[model samples]
Target: MSHAPDLGSSAAPGAGAGQREGLGELFSSVTEDLSTLVRQEIALAKAEATQSGKRAGKGAGLLAGAGVSGHFVLLFLSVAAWWGLGEVIGRGWSALVVAAVWAVVAAVLAVRGRSELRAVRGLPDTTSTLQKVPSALKGHEEENHR
Candidate 1:
């Protein structure tokens, strides 16, 4: 969290009454501020992720279109090869056999991509850092008391 101006003093802006706040009040204020800060941080991260996701989606769509264009190039080459093979095999059977092989390759690639996507995890480092915060604060407090 960023450095914030002291909130314990009654002289601070938005302070009510002409008396200093107690320790409990100070702790409450700090906790409330921390909660607010965390909420804001989460909101910012979510907004960033949403924007990044939009950009990634657009990029993926463009890539898919490119892949289709490349596939057509390959398809033409495959057709030419199939016509050559048609000299030994029947023309209709040659086309069907090539189509079947292409279908199998596409299915395998699609399944692998799905599995790779599923294997990915999010926010691993952030989660570990957040888990350590309380222990880190406790050490700081112990040092302060000593």
Candidate 2:
């Protein structure tokens, strides 16, 4: 009877070692990729924050300019109206009438401002998401137990 070669003994000596080395290289590559991803995400966040801040600054500057120009316009218009009315009525009566008109406007503005302030719902989405965190954690705990 012919004897067959032992299959187990025919295997290469370095095969297991080569496989272990490949695994180590794969793990290192994965770690490096994850680290790079985190760095990229942080860079993106910083860039977005910088862009938002620049936009907010520009908007504030424009609003300030508009406010100053609007104040000047109102001042000139009020003076013109007072002079025109003074020709029909006396200067004192015309001034009093303008003062009363401004008073009514101030009252209306105050009431509207109060209503708008009351309508403000601060960070509703953030509040709702925060409330879900505990339930989410509980679900994870149940999964782990199973």
Candidate 3:
């Protein structure tokens, strides 16, 4: 019994060693490669974004816990200061002093927070790269025409 040649082999039937691939075949191969590359790139980006999102979520949760712990520390310190002063200057005046101190702290925090918010610049690099995309595409098209 004789076996037939494999259809999946690189050598096509009736093609000689000197033969080159047709334009249609070359174009088809390039298109397929480009499509696969785009799909792989998208998958990579999605995986990266998912990993970043999980990290951000975990960081936010830890920060919230830190905030609560900090608040309790401040509360206990404030109470201790008030009680210590009350023994010296009396209860009413010590309470007033604590309230005034907190008011000043609040004012300072509000001013600093506002200034920090004003300094925020959002997504500058992403915006710049996105703006360049159209020009890049135009350049590619011009090259193809040439």
Q: Candidate 2, residues 1-146: lDDT per residue as tens digits?
A: 76997667656546777888999998898678667755765665566666655655555554555455455556655875767666775664566566566555555544554554454444444444445545544554233222
Top lDDT hit: 1
The TM-score of predicted model 1 comes to 0.42
What C-alpha lDDT values do all the predictions have?
A: 0.58, 0.57, 0.56
What residue runs in model 1 are displaced by over 4 Å at the alpha carbon?
A: 1-21, 80-146
Clashing pairs in 2: none
Backbone clash count, each prediction separately: 0, 0, 0
Q: Give per-residue CA lDDT, model 3, range 1-146, as digits (tens).
A: 65986765746544643345575676688678667756765665566666656655555554555455456557655775767676775664565566566555555554554554454444444444445545544455333222
By summed lDDT, which 10 consecutive residues of candidate 2 come out lowest?
137-146
Ranking by lDDT: 1, 2, 3
* Per-model TM against the reference: 0.42, 0.43, 0.43
Q: Predicted candidate 1: what Cα RMSD to the true structure? A: 13.2
Query: What's the distance in Å from true for residue 143, model 2?
Result: 38
